[model samples]
Target: ACTVARQKSDLFHKYALRNAANLLKPEAYLKPLEQKIKNVSSILKNKEETVLNAWHYRKKIIDEYLQYISFKRNTDKVFVWIDEHDECFVSKLEELDINDEGYMDFVRALK
Candidate 1:
């Protein structure tokens, strides 16, 4: 899903670059703003597989934790909770640490 989201964002970037009527756009704007292309380049680069795996792992954990706690709150704010502490949720929960890092890390790394 993170891959998809990045792809979609890149798609949008491509389209916008194609249709851009003004200055170069975000990338262009960022470069001079930062006075460094490397900074902007790093931001634009796809994440390493390890980082992407970590994010996927993080997402899976939050999703499970959300499901686990959904009924307890009147108006569940699952996304925020998931976002804030996914590391812990990923680190300890069975669903999140599916890899059995003695935890859920395995599950998160699957795909």
Candidate 2:
């Protein structure tokens, strides 16, 4: 389960970093973020089953955490930067009204 857990963490970090970048000022550790992405890729490369599980777990965590995410008032548009590697993995982000604040605030893979 270590492999799965590790990949899960990496995925979480990536999602957190990406989401943060979208809503807040960029921080450091980008090199580590890149490394974690590679780590998850390596883990998934050798274990295909874990890859699918990682995707699902990522979706779950993102859905849960994003409800509390609030964009700064300066925001006008949301830009998604898709990695070429993740293009074919999941469907369009299933945008949802998770915040229940009269508008949608979260996006996840469709179940």
Candidate 3:
């Protein structure tokens, strides 16, 4: 039972991170957000150690993540992804509606 609970929690975090990775500002939040998520795995290794549960932890992480993304915007920097072929892909962070079918298809192709 305990093992199953841990497995479920691990799966939840994995999916959460995967969803976050596809977000527009993911380049800014990925590293620190990953560190925050590692806390979940840490607790599974040592149950006696107290760690934030998934809900509270995820909310806190999201709040901080949004702040981090917003902070980057103030710097007036545009994130560009360069492929192995040396092709540059430029994106406008604020303009991304996250609902564009064409853009989603392009992103899938890039992966």
Models, CA RMSD each: 21.7, 29.3, 27.7
Each candidate's TM vs. the true structure?
0.25, 0.25, 0.32
Can you give the lDDT of residue 97 in candidate 1? 29
Q: Each model's number of backbone clashes?
A: 7, 0, 0
List model 2 lDDT by residue over 72-99, tens digit each. 3223223232344334433333232155
- Return the top candidate by TM-score: 3
lDDT of 1 by residue, 1-111 (tens): 445655665665556555544665666654454444334334545464657788899999999899877765634566567667777765566543244453344546532
How far off is residue 60 in model 3, in Å?
43
83 Cα displacement, candidate 2 (Å): 70
lDDT of the structure predicted as candidate 2: 0.58
Candidate 1 to native Cα RMSD, angstroms: 21.7
Which stretches of candidate 3 lie above 4 Å from their native place?
48-111
* lDDT over C-alpha atoms for residue 103 of model 1: 34
- Which residue pairs overlap in candidate 3's backbone? none
Please tell me which predicted candidate would have the highest lDDT against the true structure: 3
Cα displacement (Å) at residue 6, model 3? 2.5
